[model samples]
Target: MSKTILVVDDSSSFRQVVSMALKGAGYDVVEAGDGKDALGKLDGRKINLIVSDVNMPVMDGISFVTAAKQLAAYKFTPVIMLTTESGDDMKAKGKAAGVKAWVVKPFQPPILLDAVAKLILP
Candidate 1:
């Protein structure tokens, strides 16, 4: 089965960019504007991985990762934070929330693809 990835970000352009990258690499992609929307989208979908943004309108990536880990179906889903923020404190917070990795924004698509492939398929 193809790996299913949930791309969560408030920026439509960023989401589109990430989705295109993932799809190009042979992964199925879904999109959500925020954590709340992402949770709603996850109801019956099989999400293998998550690429999220830290700052958003409804809910941020850290909250999304923490909430996702609580559900049995998503307990082990790998979530990577793709954001502009690269502070140590933000990274620490993401780590505490069970985010698998943090990628600074303006990131290379290949790097993000590699991380997703390693985490979801390894």
Candidate 2:
């Protein structure tokens, strides 16, 4: 079966871009508008990976990851932070929240795809 990836971002356009790329690469995608929405999406549906944006309304990425990690079903699921913020402090916070990879914004699809591939072993 194809792996499922949850993508959390405030931008609908960004989510669409990511969804298309993941779909093209033979993966299923679930999209959310923010951390709160993303949290609601963690419904024991076999999510293999997560790609999140740090800045969002309702709930931020780090807070969402931290909350998600506390859940029994998703504790060890790998997360990748795809955001415009690249500060050391922010990255540190994301690491604490169990983010496995960080990709800066305005990123190429291939670079994000590479990171996703490495984390999601076939």
Candidate 2, residues 1-122: lDDT per residue as tens digits? 99999999999999999999999999999999999999999998899999999999999999999999999999989999999999999999999889999999988999999999999845
Q: For residues 87-111, what per-residue lDDT tens digits would candidate 1 score against the true structure?
A: 9999999999999988899999989
Most accurate candidate by TM-score: 2
Per-candidate total of colliding backbone pairs: 0, 0
**Cα misplacement distance, residue 102 of candidate 2 (Å):** 0.1
Q: Pick the candidate with the highest lDDT.
A: 2
lDDT of 1 at 43: 91
Off by over 4 Å in 2: none
Assess each prediction's global lDDT (C-alpha) against the native: 0.91, 0.95
Over 4 Å off, model 1: none
